[model samples]
Target: MHDHEEHDEQDSGGGAAAPARAKLFLEGRYRKLCRDLPQTVFYCPECKGHPRRRRGCARCEGFGKLTRDSVQELVGWVAGKAFGTRKHKFHGAGREDVDVRMLGEGRPFVLELLGPRTFQVDLAALEAEINRRNEGRLEVRGLHWTERQRVVVLKETPHAKEYEARVAVELAPGDPRAAQALAAARALVGTRHTIIQHTPERVAHRRADKDRERWIEFLSVELEPEVEPEVAPAPALDAAPELDAAPALDAAPALDPAAATAAANGADAAPARTYWRVRLRTQHGTYVKEVLSGDSGKTRPCLAEWIGAPCRCVELDVTAILDEHGGAEEVVEPAPADDAPFGTGI
Candidate 1:
């Protein structure tokens, strides 16, 4: 009985060993295949057709072995090998007009260095290496280890942006009408939706032509003032109490309940001075630019059409963009109770 039990134990041990041997054999085969496969041959531009030499040719300066696509591929390979990672994703804070250059602090960005085995790697050194390798055409900073999930927020956040743009306006010569129109635009109030018909000409290759609605809450314009000639000094101050007590012509009275109610409810009654330096807070996705230009009359009651003068935005900047899913309250006033019918003239 003892001999039979020992033999059973040995058979079970052999069964486990067989699978281990097989796994090792397969791994060895894979490594052998990788080694036996020929190293990819890159043409030497300097040598005119020959393979690259050990020291490399003087003419191409070893660049004969490099191509843009090949360099990218090598970067992926080295990053994977050194970090033992799968892949990486790069996220930009905001997209530039391809034609526009990002000058300051090079717009905030996040890079998802995925599946890294060496999470403890020195990030500053890695960033420096990458910047050196790219020769500063693209730069990276704020490099810190991050998780995959943060990439989602980086992509979705509606970050408020500031833009410095130079706009050109086409108006009829000697048209003071243009300035008046721009002023009227600033004083305009209330939320307005404008539908934009995106043209294929500008974004045809990358995006589909689609109609999108954007809301506008505020619009304003400023023009360089014409310098005035020197004028004589004004008269001396008046000491009369009557003059001091007299309300200043520019001063307006304190809040009138009726006027406040009207303004809150969006009545036709608006403050005087049609021209204003309009500053307003509005909803997200508002096409302030299209609202100013009218986009071929897609935006109705536009500043240009309203003032009977061509209008364009000189500078546009976003002060804030509220969270899309924010919650707001609507006030409900209590209704007055109806009087009961008198039973006997009580």
Candidate 2:
């Protein structure tokens, strides 16, 4: 993604001489894309995803792979075509499960164009094209040129991320226990909690089996209804509360967290299913899913433990990478590495 050595001195644009190396930067805005796609090319383990396998692989219907879609392939294709080369590397700050959606400003990445023959193109136009082709799927933002050194820095620099998670909950409607969960979640907002995580069960087969410490910096918590409530009709002008209303009722009803959400959304009844929208800030490489499940007790002080009930994150969206100026980590000096485009894909 970024080479340590400065390549900017060379002509990366109009100069006649071929540029030593050129890289493109893009922040991928994934709204709904990648839900069913992998971050990189997924080769079938059984047949190596080789299309020409002597015995047609029934698993992949002889196509040799499970899915043809991936964030890397989609973004890489446009850049490769524009740059006139297919050789590149994907360098991401971190990765998310394919089931997760990337949102907000999108994830930053560098695509290293290896041995580019066409040194330069209109970046703005290229960005527009990428978005147009991937409409409703993914969008590229902050597209520009950068040094290869950034790739290594991006790799080494720890990324703190924010996510919006929809979790399935088991608490009964109007359960007094909800307050305990609410209080526990709120207590984490402005503090830090160190957690010990074993290699998550899902990735244990490929990742090293070991214990790792990660931190959870809580951001926010909210109760979400399964179905969004309709906005109530505007109140009659005369029915509006007086500017100076009486404060006479001493036995006012206790606050119902769901009531607040319901009043705002116009619903008078609870949904059939209960869900909570919890926003979390976590260190790079932390197992976010495990933070909720405790991975069968491997992760301590997990969300499950905090709320004293079983919960699972059913939907997730990345809202931010809080490592740059906007977040906790200081800006890292771009370090060097290969010349291929760094695609910081999950």
Candidate 3:
């Protein structure tokens, strides 16, 4: 009986030892598999020499150094894993000429960083990193955590813009016609069908070689003294009793159409001559440069064609952008009813 009990105990001990040895072997095999796996096989910058199941590898900090799509994927993963949400969008203010540098305040813009892992980010440090990486080429400011709706609003809103450009012109000297031409340009209003051809010189690579119709409304123009100025009586004199009081001489009758047409035809006989400083307000995506240049005769009734001279926008500036579909009309105040008593209902 004693021998049998001793045998049974030995059998139990052996059974326990077998499992211990197997566990050790399994752990060793797992560690070897992790170590021997090549980092390139994973193609993850952060996962080199790390277990596949690890939360994140210290080497790349979970960011794979690859295409922008990779960055976006990693951002999505981080947001989902850390914050349990997903929201983000990119917004750029007034795009550059692709080659042109946007100087001064770098254009006012707002980026809505939404549903981030942590809205409370070290924005100053992030800005520093971006600036450092870009070498001052691109900069960002007012980097605050915001909502997704704000991003939509930013994209939709028509932000006012300002631009400065130098233009070349073919102009004559010592002619009064230029002043009239500039006046006509400034007087134009509303939408005008101006067709523009996409040329290989400027925008062929990115844009399709097609024609686009755009609207341009000239806000104002300033012309050089190519002609002498004509002086008229001051407004105060016109208002004085000497000439004004004569029963206000009913407003002059409208001119006959025949006479008007004759005057217009005569006005076009002279050649235009002057450099102009033109200011305009227009909708987004209207190619101001092409409008000014006539785009090799693509623009109809253009500044060049209108004046019958090779004309260019000597200087151009975008003063404002009018929102076409802004909102409901403003509520106007109702005029008080005549003969209504004070504090009485109408």
For each candidate, C-alpha RMSD in Å?
A: 25.8, 13.7, 26.7
Best candidate, TM-score: 2
| Angstrom error at residue 24, model 1 | 30
lDDT tens per residue, model 3, 1-346: 0000122223455464222110000000000011111111234444533445234655545544222232223222333333334543334334434223344333333332333333233434444454454343344433333333443544566543333434444655555665566556666633444445454356565576666655555545555544466898578855766655545456768788998997888864655445666655444565667677777876565766665567765444333323443222222121133233322221
Each model's C-alpha lDDT? Answer: 0.41, 0.71, 0.42
Q: Per-residue CA lDDT of candidate 1, range 214-246, in tens?
A: 444443345444346799987557743454576
Candidate 2 or 1, higher lDDT: 2
> What's the TM-score of every candidate structure?
0.41, 0.71, 0.41
Colliding residue pairs in candidate 1: 215-286
* Candidate 2 local lDDT, 77-112, one digit each (tens): 888888788877777767778788888767667676
Error of 2 at 307 (Å): 1.0
Q: How many clashing residue pairs appear in each of the predictions shown?
A: 1, 21, 0
Candidate ranking under lDDT, highest first, comes to 2, 3, 1
Residue 342 of model 1: what lDDT? Answer: 16
Model 1 lDDT at residue 325: 30
